[model samples]
Target chain A: MVDPTESPATGSSIRHEDHGDDLRTVRLAGRLDMLGMEPIALKFTSLTASHAQQVLVDLREVSFLASIGIRSIVSSARALESKGGRMALLVAPGSTVEATLTSTGISEVIPIHTEEAEALAGLGAAG
Target chain B: MAALTPADELHIQPDPETLRTASLWLAERCRQRSVPQELIDRLDLCLNEVLANLIDHAGPGVLEIPVELVLDPGDRRGGTPLSLRVRDGGAPFDPTAAPSPTAPTVLAETGIGGLGLVMVRRFCDEMHYRRVNDFNELTLLLAWPQETPDR
Candidate 1:
C-alpha cells in the first residue's frame, strides 16, 4: 500500500492499495476540478497507467468533479488500455461524481461501478 | 415576488486560479438563501465550467476586465428557480449555440474537448447567451423539485 499526502490547496488525496495478483486500487478523495487534479494527477498516473496494471479508482469520497479531471482520468485510462491493462471507476451511487461521469458518457468506455465487488470483478474478468 | 430577485453578485477576474473563489462564493450565497444542497452543487459545477472557459478561451483581453456573476432566485413555487448570470468583456462566444459532441464508445476516440459545455448544458435547465455592448453575457438557470429539503 502506498499512501500519499493530501493537497492543502485543493483538498485532494490519492493512495494505492495492492490486492495482490497484479491488481491495484487507487482511492481518490476530495474535489476533482482544475485545482484538485493538480496534486494527484502525476501520482495517479504513475500508480495506474505507468505500470500497465489493473486499477480500480475509488471515487466515493469525491465531492466535486469537473471536465478537466475527467480528462485526466480518460487520458490515464487510455494509456492503461494501450498497454494491455484495464481500469474501472468506483463511484458512489447517485453522486455528483457519478452523474458527471454519466453525463460525459464515459461509462461506455470506462466501466463505473457503484459496488467495489462489482468493480473488482469486472477488472478481474478483463485479465 | 418579482419575476426574479437578484440575491447577490460576485465580480472575479478571468483567471483560472480564481475559479475556486467564485465557486465558493456562489455556494455560500446559495446556502444563505436557503437553496437546496443539490441545487447548490449543480450551480457550483456549472460555475466552474463557465468561468474556466472564459479564462481559457476568452483570451488575454478578458484578463483586463472583471467577470461578473449574479445570483437570481425565482419566486418559490413548484420548484425553487435559481439563475446564475456571468458577464465578461471577452471574445463573443455563445456556449448555448455550440454544437454538442456525439457520445464516445471508445476511450481512444473520446476527446475531452467541448465536454465542459456539455456538462454545463446537462446540469442547467436553460442556458442563454447574448452579446451586449461588446460583453458576452451567459446565464445558466436551474431549479430543484420543491420536495427537496433546504440545507
Candidate 2:
C-alpha cells in the first residue's frame, strides 16, 4: 500500500505507491538539503522497512541535492539492503542531481537510471 | 594588486533555514553573472555542507553570532577564480585539518559525519581555513572557465 499523505515535518513532499508484486516506488520532490532530509529520511526508512523486496526512489523532481540528502538515500538504501532488498534511483541525465550523485561516488554504489523503464528493469520491477 | 571587494555579502542566522537562503542567493548571483550551472551547483553544494557543519558542531554560541558569507568574483573577465568566504563567530574548528573520510565501499559502511567535508574538498578547486580572532573563516575557490568567459 502507498502512503499518499505528505509529512509536513521535512518540508519536502514524499509519497509512496505500491507497484504490486511487492514492488514500491517513492517519489521525492523539492529541495533535499539539510532541513528537508530529516522527515524524508524517517519516512523513507520506515517505508523501506515495510517493503523488503524492492524500492525505487524517483529523484526526477528533486531540484537540489545536498550531502545530507545523499546521506539519507545511502542510509535508506543500506537499511533496505540489509533486509535483502534493493533501492534504485531515477535521475535525469545532465542534471545537477546526477552530477552531485556522480561526484560523491554515490552512482557507484546505487544504480542510477535516466529513464523510468530502465530503472524498473534494473530493479526487476519492469512490467 | 587591487584589493578584492566582495561582489555580495549575506549575514544569516546560524540555522538550517540559512541553507535555503544561501543557496538561493548563490543561484541568483550566478544567474545574473551568467555563471555556468555546473559551477553554481558545486558552489551551492559546498556552501550547504559547510554551513550545515557549522550549525551542527559550532556549539550554542553560533546562535548569538550571525554567520557571514562573502562572495568574491575575482576578475571575471580575466578568468580569476571565484571565491566564497564563510565566517562564523563560533569555537575555532578548522575543517581543512579534519581527517578526510574514506569513501565507503559498501552501503553499511557509509556514515554521515565526515562526508560533508569530503564533498567540500572534492568540489572546490581550493580551500583555505583560518581562525583569526574569534572567527572561523573558511574560504573556497573555484576556477571559472576561461572559454565561457561569463557568457
Candidate 3:
C-alpha cells in the first residue's frame, strides 16, 4: 500500500512495506534528484539502515535518479549490510533508474531485480 | 559553441536552492523544442551533476557569480545533435578530465564520491570544457541513438 505522507515540493515519496519474517520493502516514487531526495533521504536511511534486515527498495516508480540519490541508497545499503542485513533494489528493466544503476556499476555490488518475487528471494539468500 | 541570445539563456546564482529552478527551466525549454524524453532525462542528470559540483566545490567566492545555461539543439544530421553549455565563474574544473571512479564490487568498497562525474560521463555523448574569458564553460552533448534501417 502507498503511504499518504508524500513530499509535494520535490515530488518524492517513501513508504514501507512489511512482508513478514523480517522482510520489508521501501517503495520510492517521483524523481530522486537533489530536491526529490530531501523529503525521503532521512526516512529511507533510517528504515533501511537501522530497522530492516532484508530490505527491498522498489524504484519502479522513480522517474529520475541523480548521483545524490544513488549515494543515499549505497550508503544505507552499506550500513544495513554492516549490521548483518541485506538490501536489494527492484527497478524496471529498461527504465532510466535501471540505466543509471547499471552505468554506475551499482548492479554489481547490490542485487537489482526487475520482479518483486525475485528481488525478495535474492534478499533471502545468505550474503 | 554558439552564443545564446538573452532569450535562450537562464541565469541563476550558484546556490543549491536554485538547482530545481535550473532543472525546470531546462525541462521546459526541451519540451518546447520537442526534444526526446530520453535526451531530456540525460540532460537533466548531467546538468545536476555539473551544477552540484560547482556549488559544492567551486569555493565560496564563486557563489557570487551567476551560472549560465544554454541549450543548443545542434544540426540533426546525427553527430551530437543536442548540447547544453553551462557557463560559470567558478574555478576551472574539467569533468571530462576527471577520472571516473571504479565501480565497487562490494558494498564495503562503495563510496559516494565521484559518482556524479561518472554519471555525467555515461550519460553525455561528449563533454567539452574550456576556460572562456575567465568563465569555466562546459558543454555536454547527447545524441539520438541511431535507428537501424529495415534490413
Each candidate's number of clashing pairs is 0, 0, 0
| Candidate 3 per-residue lDDT over residues A27-113, each given as its tens digit | 999988877888789888888899548999999999988888999999999999888899989999889899999999999999899
Interface RMSD of candidate 1, in Å, is 1.1
Clashing pairs for model 1 are: none
Model 2 C-alpha lDDT per residue in residues B1-151, reported as the tens digit of each score: 3325447899998677777888889889778777788888889889999988877787766766988898877766565788899999988889888988766667677666687887898889999999988898999999987774355
How close to the true structure is residue A68 of candidate 1, measured as C-alpha lDDT? 83
Candidate 1: clashing residue pairs, number:
0
> Candidate 2: lDDT over CA atoms?
0.81
Off by over 4 Å in 2: A5-11, A125-127, B1-6, B148-151
User: What lDDT would each prediction earn against the true structure?
Assistant: 0.85, 0.81, 0.84
**Predicted model with the maximum DockQ:** 3
- Model 3: interface root-mean-square deviation in Å: 1.1
Tens digit per residue, CA lDDT, model 3, B1-151: 3323223689898565688888889899888766788888888999998888887788878988988888877644444468789999987787778887877987888988998999899999888999999998998888856656778
Predicted structure 2, TM vs. truth = 0.90
Proportion of native contacts in model 1? 0.82
Model 1 per-residue lDDT at A116: 98
